[model samples]
Target: MRCSCCQKELINSLTLQELFFSSSQRCYHCEQLFSKIDQAQVCPGCGRPNSTELCQDCCLWQQELGFVMRNFSLFSYNEGFRQWIETYKFMGDYRTRGAFVLELTEALQKYQEYLICPLPLSKERFEQRGFNQVRGCLDLTKRSYELLLKRSELAPQSEKSREERLQMKQPFELNVPIEKIRNQKVLLVDDVYTTGRTLFHGAELLYKSGAETVKSLTFAR
Candidate 1:
C-alpha cells in the first residue's frame, strides 16, 4: 500500500493482529499525521480536541443560538487531511475513498438507528464535483437520505470568515415532509465541519420540522 497523501510506498510485515483487526490503508507516517480527536479531551459540544472545559466556539454558539449541538469528528482538519479532502472530493480521485472507509464506517455505526443524512451540494457544485463528498465516504450498509437540498449556489464556506459563516443565510431546504421526519433523530453527515455553519443550518431546519434530536458527524473538524 501507499500513503494517501504523500503517495509514498508503505512497507511493513503484517502481524496476526493487524491481519485480523487493522483496517489502515495508509502508511504509518501518513496515518500518524491524520490526528484523531481524543474522546476524553474533546469539548462537550463540538468534539474538537481542546484543553478548555468548553470551547469558545461552542460557548458562543450556545449564547447566540440558544442551543448547543453534539458533533463527532474523526480527524483534525490539518494540512494532511485537507489535501486528502481535496483529492477525493474536489479532484475526483474516487480511489481515495478506500483510505477512509473503515474508519468512517466504524464511527457511523453508533448512529445507525438515527436518520442518517448526507449534506447536500448545490446543483452547480454537484455538477462540478461529480459526487457528494459525504456520501462517498460512507459504506453501503449505512443508509442515508436526500432530506435536504441546497437552494442555490453560494460563496465557498472556506473563503468566508467565522462571522460571515455564522451569519450566512440558510442555504438548505427540506425535501422530506415534517410528517415524515417528526420526532426522528437526525444525524447529519458531512465531509468537514469548519465553523459549524452548514450543519447548524441543517439542524435548524430539522428542528423546525420537529426532529427529536439533531446531531452531526464529520470526517474532519
Candidate 2:
C-alpha cells in the first residue's frame, strides 16, 4: 500500500490504529494523533504546508499582522475539505465531522499535556449556523477542555483586510478567569484558521488567562 499524500509505501508495522486513523475514520486516533509537535507530511490539524518554518508570505503576514505564534495543520481548506466542514457543522452533515474526527484521531494519538478548546461562535451566529464546527471536533476527541472565553458577535473579520481585521473589534472576551489557566499548556481547536485572526484572539485570551504555553490545531490554516 501507499500513503495517498506522500506516496510512502505502507508497512505492516503500521497497526490497524494507524490504517484506520489515516482514513479520516477513527475516533480515538482522531482525538489523539492531531496534537503532535510535528507533522508527518502536512500537519494533522491546521494543514499548514511545508515544514516547521513559514513561507515568505506567511512570515510577512505574521509580522505585519502582529500575530505572536501560529501552528501547522492537516487538511487545506480547499474545495473538498471546505464543503465537508461546512456541511458537517452548518448543514447538519455529521458524517463529514465523523470522518474528519477519525483523521484527527489518527493525527493526535501520540499527544499529551494539552487542554483543547473549541472556537466559540456568538450565540446569534450559533443560532444561525446551527452548530459550532469546533464543538463537533471536541465531541469526537477525548482531550481536556476549557472555555477560556466567549467570542462576541463582531463584524466579519474575514471580509476585512488584515488591517481592517485587526481594527474591526476586540474579537473575543474571557468568560473563564485568568487564574484558572496559570502555567498550563493549551491546544486550541478550530475548524479553520484562515487569516488566523480568530485563533490568535483565542490564544491571547488563554495567554492572558495565564496559560504557560499555547498551541493550536485547526482543520484548515
Candidate 3:
C-alpha cells in the first residue's frame, strides 16, 4: 500500500505481524512522525501525551463543570498528524481512512457496551463535505448510529481560536430518542479534540438525556 501522508509506495509491504499488531497505513518514515500517546505519561482527563497530571484545561473543566471528562486520544497532534488530517478531512482523501481503521477498530472494541456516536457537522458543512470525517475513519463490525445533529450553522471549529471555541454556544442536538440512550454509556467520537469544548457540549446533552456516563474518543488531541 502507498503511504497515506506522502503517497509513496511503502518499501516494506504489510506483514502478518503488522496486519495483526500495528496499523500499516503509513510508511515507516510517516508512521514515525505520528506519535501515539504514551499510556503512562498522559493526562487522566484528556489523554494528551507526556502529562503526569491533569492538564490545566481539564482542571478548569472539573472546576466549572463539576466533573472531569474521561477522554481517550489515540495520537498526538504533531505536524505529520496535522498533514494527515488535512489530506483526509479537508482534501477528502477517502483512502486515508484505511490507515487508521485497524487502530480505531481495536480501540473501540473495549467500549462495546457504550453507544457510539459521531459528532455531527452542521447541515451546510455536511452537504459540502459529503461525509462526516469522524465516521469515515471508523470500521465498526457492530452497530452504531449518527445520533447527534447540529443545532444550527456555525463556523468550523478549526477556524476558531481556543477562546473563541470555548465561547461558542451549544451546537448539537440529539436526533435519537432520549429513551434509547437513557442509562447507556455514550461514547462521542470525533476526528480531533482541540479545546474539549465541542465534546463537553456533547457530553452535557447526553447527561441531560439521562445517559449513565459520557466520554470521548478522538483520533487525535
Residues 131-213, candidate 3: write the lDDT tens digits. 88887766433446556545555688999999978766777777887788789998899888899988999998888889899
Q: Model 2, range 39-118, lDDT digits (tens) per residue? A: 55542323466544455545664576544454646665566565555566667765445555555765565447776667
Between prediction 2 and prediction 3, which has the larger lDDT? 3
In order of appearance, the predictions have TM-scores of 0.83, 0.68, 0.83
Stretch of 10 with least lDDT, candidate 2 = 29-38
List runs of model 3 lying over 4 Å from the truth. 1-25, 140-143, 153-168
lDDT of 1 by residue, 1-221 (tens): 56544556766686778756876667776676577878788887888887537789988988977778899999989998887877778789876775666677787788867888888888888889898777776644355555554554568999999897876688877786668678988899888888998888888888888989998998888
Which should have the higher lDDT, number 1 or number 2? 1
Worst 10 residues of 1 by lDDT: 140-149
Task: Please give the lDDT score for candidate 3.
Answer: 0.80
**On TM-score, who's better, 2 or 3?**
3
1 versus 2: better TM-score goes to: 1
The ten-residue window of minimal lDDT in model 3 covers 139-148
